[model samples]
Target chain A: MLRLFKNKFFLLLLITVFIFILMGVTAKQNSKLNWFSNTINVIFSPVEKFFSGIGDKIGSGLSYFGDVKEVKKENAKLKSDIDKLEKDTADLERYKQENDRLREALNLKNQFNQYDSIGGNVIAKDPGNWFDIFTVDAGTKDGVGNNYPVIAGSGLVGRVLNAGFISSKIMTIIDVDSTVSGMLTKTGDQVIIKGDLSLKEQGLCRMDYIPTDEDISVGDSVVTSGIGGYYPKGIFIGKIKEIRQTNNEFTRYAIIEPVVDFKRLEEVFILKNKNVGNTGTDGAGK
Target chain B: MKARNIVFAVSIFIIVVLQTTVLHYIKIFGITPNIMVVVVIGIALLFGNTQGAIAGFILGFCQDITFGKMLGFYALAGLYLGLVVGIVNKRLYRENILVIIFFTFISTIVYELSVYLVHEWGMHLFSPENSNNLDILYAVRNITLPEAIYNSIISVPIYALMIRINDRFENANKSIRKY
Candidate 1:
């Protein structure tokens, strides 16, 4: 046994077996890190955050120089747009009060809007191109937890995969492993949006299970149906980009152009359900 | 020797931090060069199999913990890569830039393909969706080839730096031995 241990090839084989075993054990979704990994994360989070801040500053600084003329033109355009939006907001506020009164009369719950959200910065991304997982600066300390729905400014990003002490891993919607229950905003048809390995390079997702007879067209919006307990209802996913016919004529899949610019993603918001206790199958069914 | 080990360990940590944070901004075609693979190759070429393997394992483990869905996949890839490169260390001209670049390009392809295979196998075992040969062909053309090219280009400066550091450590060790 001592001589076998001394043999380099034998030692290599042992380590290989050990690692394979470790992979098997931790292959499941939402696997908690051991003490060693947790400790490393605890130490690495702040450092990663600091470096990410510097990188962000450098990136913006470089872009600022290159796009100064364009920025000024865009700024003037945005000012007019803001003025128009302010007038629209005033009209919407009056409508909102009337809607609130009607909702109170009907005793209907505001299913999507009743959640607390914590903001986080993207500190680190997965080192390889194979996965779209990233580390965010929010953790359980900030009331962020596993399976919390994360979103960017434009639309749905993904959900928290694992929450550490001061950092959480987010699996974005473009990752091959990600799947969300979504619906067409125009026709109210339920569809499954999943990440495909080939499409991930283009920062797009695959929307599958569309009924043949559904009048779904390119540019129709898709949102969470709230059927999956993970995401709340009515969160904007993306617009259909292209429709493709499957081998089975009854079903088709469409490519989705996600509204979030995932490559340039810097910040995100993780939504925490206020009524956490009642987030059961009953609510999912509705 | 101890100082060399410390420097290697610290450099690995720094590489991980830089790869995750700073490297994301510098992506070409939505893919960052795998700097860890370059560094592992550098170590294996400079120090032989044992050190190379150890470096690969450590780097792989760090990546697996931080970003991987499975704990040992990267670790396994890194370990084998380091071992294989280290085995060839004895016969190669370590100072030749082209040789290093060629090694890095090939190693990255092997590393990424192994990762793809393991992931596909896992998907086959656990998930309902089975990836077909088209997906494999697409991955090789789009992902593996571009990544390998990127890694090879970036390997030049990184390998040079590793050579300098290794030379400095060896000279210091020689002086100590003489004393």
Candidate 2:
């Protein structure tokens, strides 16, 4: 039996079978991946970071070189735009103070109150292109953990799948395995927003199980319902692009066009779990 | 342990990094050709099974951490991909572009089928959102076929580079022997 196992073909077959079963075992949702099993991420984080930095520079620098005069003109326009934004910022600040005073007077919590987040630059991506899994430079070392919500300027990007000591993998909203509890902002009608590979090319998702009678339609805003303890309520998910009636029991689905531009994604903010009680709200640094 | 081994390992690392980083920005018709697959097949064909298996196993394991929902999902598929592709070792000339194209096309088909099968199986075992939604035929038509065609076109250059690498190392070894 030992000799039989020693044969290469037999050994390969055994190993393959073992891994196939192991795949099922490991397929279920887990909180954190062991760092020991994922030392490769640790080993390659810096190199990936360096290359990503260069890639970002190259992408931007090329456009700058194409037309220096255009950049100069844009620079002048941006400077004036910044001056205008400064005025807008001051007005918004005054409103924020007034709003805060009213909330405090009424003893009401700020509806815009959200968890504190630490930002990280996207260093590497999942080699396979079908799904939008990627890695970030931040990790447990940077106060991020598994299931922490990842976001960009426009909206929800994804959540941390697992955290290594120095790096973590993020499963984007459009990954086929990702399912988030979602509801329409306009109608409050709930639906399950999950990743579908077919629609992933367009950076879109399939929102399923909508009621036939539900008045859901194109352009409805979807956000996290916070039904699942994983993601907090009201994180902007995406807007519906198209709706289709499925033959399944629930019968209706919609396509979500994510607000985050996943194709050009370079940096992301990972929100700390809100229940931890340190809602500092400073999320715009490194 | 040898310099050639070091070169081979570094090549894998570089290819992986390139696949994830630069390749993310490069897509045609929203399909990104998997360069790692082509590289692994080329390595397996050139280097034979033990090296091929080890390379495939490590690459697959890393890929699991990268893209898989579970730990060993991509690892098992990658391991088998290398092993199966390695079986046709040294039979075809390394320099032949036609051989690279044929092997990449076939290997990609096999790889995609395995992904679909394992994905469906896993969804069956561990409850997917709607297990009925895991359609294998739909995946093949939409995802696999286009990727296979793209990889076949992309494999030619990677295999050519692999051939160049093999030649360079062999020549260096010959020079050392002469000394």
Candidate 3:
């Protein structure tokens, strides 16, 4: 064993294996428990948040011309109204966004009245097309913790993965690892809403365990059933886009398109509900 | 040695930020290249097994801290990848760009698969619905393959940066010896 330690290859393997074992055992705990991971989050979260700010600016800057073209196109569509409403159009557009935000806040506040929320800017995201996971600027200082339900606008975004001092990692609903208990709003059918890696690009998920006689169909809305105690009841999950009935017939599932557009998401809300148990969310390595 | 360590640490830090912030916006075939993989491959190919393993571990750990909740899966994958690639490159010459691209591509695939196996499929037995819908082929086609090509594309510039940094370290060592 002593001689084997001298072999650099074996030494590296031993070191990695030990760390992996330690991590695997603690994977379910508060992620901030690891000092090293916490320190990294502290150091990088701000830096990431800073870059994300710049990223948002740069994205808007680059798309400025596209926005202009859109305005021009809309101007043509409402040419008669444009003559009288041209100046107000700009203010109207601005108000439209503000109104949308206020409406979202109002809806979120009303729906999750029992839960308190800490709003944060989305600082960083997974590099890949899949929004299975991403990072946010808020952390433990903001009272966010593991498995806290996250929301954007009116839709269910995801849950908190790691809540650091200055930042938190969010696992988006469209990720393969996330599984939420959902109910079909119209028919009250219970099903499992899960992130499907296959449908990730389309910003969709798969609904599992749909009974053949649940009176479910395309366009049925799905919301959190609150069975797991991690997420509260009645969080809007998504709307069903399609259904896939397998040969087993027992393995029926539906494709759900998440309302939260992973592409344009810039900010999100982290819910701090008092009555919830500790649950863990983890994402795959890219 | 301290300065070299700082250089590696700083580069990985910047790469992690870019991976999450800037790289998030840029996508090819609906996926962004694994930039950290390119950086690790570059370090491994240029710096030897020791530095490669350490760099990979740090990079992987940072990635986990930034983008994931589970801490050490990526760290272990990175450490092993660095070691594997670093040792493998000992037999090949870095003068050939093709060799780096090929090896980097393979390394990226291995790393992606390791994550999928450890993180995704580890709980495969519990989710029977997912068990029947095997997605290895889908994952390979959609994620790993596109990422391999993307990593290779970025590996060229990372290789140049590695060569320059490696030379600087060697020159600094030489100057110290002369003094």
Query: Which of the numbered candidates is closest to the native, going by highest TM-score?
Result: 1
Q: DockQ of all candidates, in order?
A: 0.71, 0.59, 0.63
lDDT of each: 0.84, 0.76, 0.77
lDDT digits (tens) for residues B1-179 of candidate 2: 39888987787788777777777666777777888788778888888756667777877777786556677777777777887787775545766778788888888878977777767666666665544366667677877788889999998777778888888989988898997
Off by over 4 Å in 2: A1-6, A21-33, A72-114, A247-250, A277-286, B130-132, B135-138, B176-179
Tens digits of per-residue lDDT, candidate 3, B1-179, equal 99987887788788888998898677876888888888888878877777788888888887777775567767787887887898888846876889889988998888887777666555575445434245789878898899898899889888987888889899999999997
**Which regions in candidate 3 have their CA more than 4 angstroms from the true location?**
A1-6, A66-71, A76-111, A127-131, A248-250, A274-286, B125-133
Residue A143 in model 3: shift from native, Å? 2.1
Best by lDDT: 1
Please list, in the order the candidates appear, how each scores on TM-score for chain B only.
Answer: 0.94, 0.90, 0.91
Over the stretch A141-229, how does candidate 2's per-residue lDDT look in tens digits? 88887677888994889888777678888989898877888977766777899988788777888898786778877888888876665
Q: Report how far residue A277 has shifted in candidate 3, in Å.
A: 7.5
Q: Please give the lDDT score for candidate 3.
A: 0.77
- The residue pairs found clashing in candidate 1 are none
* Local lDDT at A197 for model 2: 77
Residue B107 miss distance in model 3 (angstroms): 1.7
Better of 1 and 3 by TM-score: 1
lDDT of 1 by residue, B1-179 (tens): 78987997889889999998999788888778999999988889888877888899999988987887778888888888998998977647988988998999999998898888878777777765634223778788889999999999999999989888988988998998997
Worst 10 residues of 2 chain A by lDDT: A277-286
Candidate 3 fnat reads 0.76
